[model samples]
Target chain A: MRYLVPLLLSTLVWWILTEAAQAWVVGVPVILVSTWVAVRLQDTDSGSAPTHRLNWFAVPRFALFFLWQSLQAGLDVAKRTLKPVPDINPGTLYYYTSIPHGTARYFFGAIVGLFPGTLCTEFSEDTDQLVLHVLDTDVDIALDCRRLEREIERLFKLPAADQQGRPA
Target chain B: MNLAFDIVLGLALLLTALGVFSSKDLFRAVVMFIAFGLLLALVWVRLDAPDLALAEAAIGAGLTGVLMIDAVAHLSANTLQNDQRDDQYDHSPKRPLWLPVISCVGLFVLLLGAIRFRPEASVSLPDMVRDNIAESGVEHPITAVLLNFRSYDTLLEIAVLLVAVVVAMALKPAAEDRVHQPPPAHDPILHGLTARLLPAMLLVGMYVLWAGSYMPGGAFQGGAILAAALVFLQLAGFAVDRYAASLLRLGLALGFLVFLTVAVSVMIGGRPFLTYPEGFAGQLIFFIEAMLTLSIGLILFSLFSQNPPHSGAVGHQGANHDQ
Candidate 1:
């Protein structure tokens, strides 16, 4: 029962990797071994770590929003760096996030760096503070971070924490 | 136009090589060396050898850079403690420039002459490979050549890798200190990236191994990707090496053992050393490659993991020290 998700995923991976039928001769053993390894690794953490449950229905919306944001941010960065004098104001901002300290918050930190002028350098779990380095400190980075946090919360269907209304 | 691009690339490659050698800071030199590897990969691509390009980029640029940076970090830390000794060592290092210049020029001339006057092979090896590729049991000529035509070479390569890894394991410092150290503080960013990227990396490694049957990918490339994924997991504070020590030892040698077993087992059927039985060649090659990928991945990861972790931390500090 513990191996179901990993086994299914590994088999799907095997199918995708080698579409040929004959490959299953070796694929079967490989998939089984891989699943065993995965299950073992998962067991290493015990029950303390939260298993992330991604809402498939929300992925498309999140991905599209992410892609658009990244494109705009990338262009903004290019413009800032390629300028004659390199117009920029760089500083750090600490974001106290409401998103819990699991995969969702971690993912939020990862993608936040891709947004225009923002880089997530550190995340303090106890404080739920995401330390961000931004190219232009003048821009309101907190607003975008809050909006993105909400987007991730929706994607994960995480229980709404009452902290969203808390001051940024 | 292509010639122009190649010439520019060639120049850039030379410049990066110079940068690597001439940089005052070891960290910068390592960075330059990485750039040199990338440019060399580009050169391989331009020469229409995507396989070499992938290997060069992954192993030469990526893995080697990390190793070298780790080494540089160790050196920096040592120098910090032995600052006076380092100054004395630096002052004593004045070798005459003309000696290297003369030797380098002589070596270049010798290489040029060798290229100009080399005799053609009596047998056209590529032609022979092309003609018999179908018999070798794989669609890709490179795969067929590697796994079938010249399998002795491949066998020896795996053996060499096994020997190298065994040596690494033997030379590693006491494991007690590392085992007792606290797990790295959980950083949401690293954990998040690992969660997302690890699966994709594993998938790509498998895809590359599978693609070797019909394209410019193979066990080596796939293995390197797998190793990179393992390294990434370790970096993210997952001590996989600690959890699966016995399994990892088996994995480290499984490919070589499997290859050797198959090679010798074939002789019992009255065929020559490595010639797979007529129709079973494809399946056998696939099986060997699958094992080889796992073994190679584990072997490479072990090499990186065997190093003391603090040496790598020192390398990080060295980068900041330079800046």
Candidate 2:
């Protein structure tokens, strides 16, 4: 039942994305089978990490923010790297996250690279932390990260971190 | 201006290729090879072959990079931890390089000579393809060629992929490649992104697959994207167990099974093998492609995964990193 909602939503998405009207006769089956395969593949023991918990209403707003930030990042990277002197200080720093260790942590690794002046170099299992390479030290990149995390928390509607440090 | 862009792209490709072959550092060489693949994709675009561009960019560059990086990580495990210099991995070839160098140069010249002196064709091939494309089921000539005009070739290609998966499974890279890796730390950023991106990526993959009927996309490109999304999930800490493994195996076999069933059914219905009935050609082809898309997606993902990749099971590292 946990997989049902995502499966149905994904199937609908699959049909529309595949332009089902072209061959309506066979379209529904194709999308359903593929979505089932996807759902099966994403089977997880960690309930808190499931994507279905996300607040769908906040998605577009988050996407816009992500896009604008990425553009800014792109421009910043281009300027610093393309300059005659390469006005940049490259260094790595650790970021401790409270999101679950599975899909959520992995998504952050990919996304952090797109953020301005910061790239996720590694996520250490022992430390429960991410190693981020930053272009500038003067900027409060951690503050930016926290802000992004706030937006993401709202979007995913992940249980707020409790006093005991476990997500509810 | 176009000529200049072409020249630059060509030069970059050549340089990257050379770097890939000649670099002493194994890591640098692999990186250069990935860059070479990206440049090759651009060259394909310049040549007006968007289908090839998409495949090259996705499979040739993206997935290949992932595989090579995985391999390098395995290789460097010993050298980095032990602080011992392994001189066995020499840059120079053990055998004389002259023979390979001479033969390659000879082949290059011969190919150049053949193209330069080739006779002009009396028949216009594009006109021929365009003329019969309507009867070929799909609107795109390339898809038509792949599915109808020369479906046997596509079948054989799927067979090749099947053989690759079977061989990989037999080789036990599946067991040694994964281990009891620690789960990822809580990361809200990743959690949020996955929630948003996975479905969207899947949608884009389907878009590409569907568009292949009329445009510059296909099962391979779409499957690569799907495989990438799954890989992202895997890297994020998703566990694959026995049940998931069997389901993935089913996905690996789905394409061939569907294709064979469709072909044999057509024969049983008194039509020639692989020839669809008059009014149902498009529907049949779409059905086959849809199955192929899932199979290809699962198979490609399994190429790197161990354990039950499709349904989520715990995996042990099969590829032993002997330091």
Candidate 3:
């Protein structure tokens, strides 16, 4: 029962890769072995613990939000770079994140780079601080970081109370 | 139009080669070399050799790029006190410069002569390959030639890889030096990427291995993808090598052992060495390829992993130095 999700996923991947029913001769063993390895790796890596589950229902909403933000931010950066004067203030800003450590926290870190003008460069777990290099530090990056963190928290189904991640 | 494209590609390849040779910065040279590998892969594709293209891109561009960058990082890390210069590591006594020039000119003339006066072969190699491909157990001519007609060459290639990896293992730094280094801090981004991408990589590796029976994909390409996945996991701070040491050692030699066993076992059945029994050739070849994929993947990954982490100071920045 514990291996059901990983097993199904591996089998689905195997079927897709081979696309022939006869391939199951080799696929069956490969799928089983891969699922076992996945289970083992997850067990050893605490960050990938199964407790934090992604809400599939919220994925499309998050995806659309992410894509739109990335497109806008990408253009913004491009416009700045293409200017004669190159209107930009390149500086680093440290922002404390409220998302707890693990896959969700990492997802937050990953998406922070795509947010407008900010690229997460150094993430200190002990301090819950994300050192971001921004194209224009003049903009209010805290608001954007909080909003993105909230979306990721929702996507991972963490409780609202978990926002007080490490007490500053 | 095709000729024009080829000419442009050739020029670009030469330019990248020049960039690689002329760049003062080691990092830039490595990057240019990677570009050269990609262009060479394109040339292989234009020549109608998808198999060579795949192998070249995966090994030459991808794996070699990572290795070269890792080496450059190691060099820079070791020489932090000195300015980064092209000749910082050139400690060898300077020899006569004309030695290289004469050798290069001599080799160029020899190659030109060989190409201009190449003899006509008595056998129509391609037609012969086409004729025997049916009996070789695979539809793809390259796979047929590699596994069936010229399996000895493949066997020796695997043997050579095994020897190279064994040497790497032997030359790896002492465990005590590695033990003192701090474990890389878990980066959520790299961890998440590895978590999501690993299964997909495994699937692609398997697919490429299976596709060799009918297309350009094969053990080498599949193995390289698998190795990349392993390296990704290690870079993401997973202790794959520490946990899977015994299993990895077994995997590193499985292909060669299986191939040798099959070859010798078949000889006991009054058949010649490395020749599969008539009807069982397909299954045998597939089995051999499967083992080879795993072994090759492990071997390549070992080569990368064998290098010691540069120093404890660079542990915080996990971008280049790996344990």
What tens digits encode model 3's per-residue C-alpha lDDT throughout A1-168? 658878988988888777765787778877887888777766665644334778879999899889989998989989998999998998988777877776787777787887889888987767678788888878777777777888887898987645542311
Q: TM-score each candidate.
A: 0.90, 0.76, 0.89
lDDT of 3 by residue, B140-257 (tens): 8898888889999999999999999889888978878777777765666677677666877887898899899998998889999999999889878887767467888899999999
Residue-wise C-alpha lDDT for candidate 1, range B212-275, written one tens digit per residue: 9989898999999999988878777676766457888899889999999999999999989988
Query: Could you say which candidate leads in TM-score?
Result: 1
C-alpha lDDT score of every prediction, in listed order: 0.81, 0.74, 0.82
Number of backbone collisions per candidate, in order?
Answer: 1, 22, 0
Of 1 and 2, the candidate ahead on TM-score is 1
- DockQ ranking, high to low: 3, 1, 2
Summarize candidate 2's per-residue lDDT along B1-323 as a digit string, tens digits.
99999999999999999999887777777778889999999999999999999999988998888777666655555454544565556445579889999999999999999999999999998998999988888898888888888899988889999999888788663554455534543344554456445766877787788888888887878888888887776665554434456698888899999999999898888988888888888878877887888888888888877422221222212122322
Question: Which ten residues in a row are the worst by lDDT in model 1 chain B?
Answer: B309-318
Count steric clashes of candidate 1. 1
Error of 3 at A142 (Å): 3.7
* Models sorted by TM-score, best on top: 1, 3, 2
Please rank every candidate by lDDT, starting with the best. Answer: 3, 1, 2
Q: For residues A6-96, could you state the per-residue lDDT of candidate 1 as single tens digits?
A: 7888888778767654566556776776777676655543334465677879999999999999998989988988999998999988768
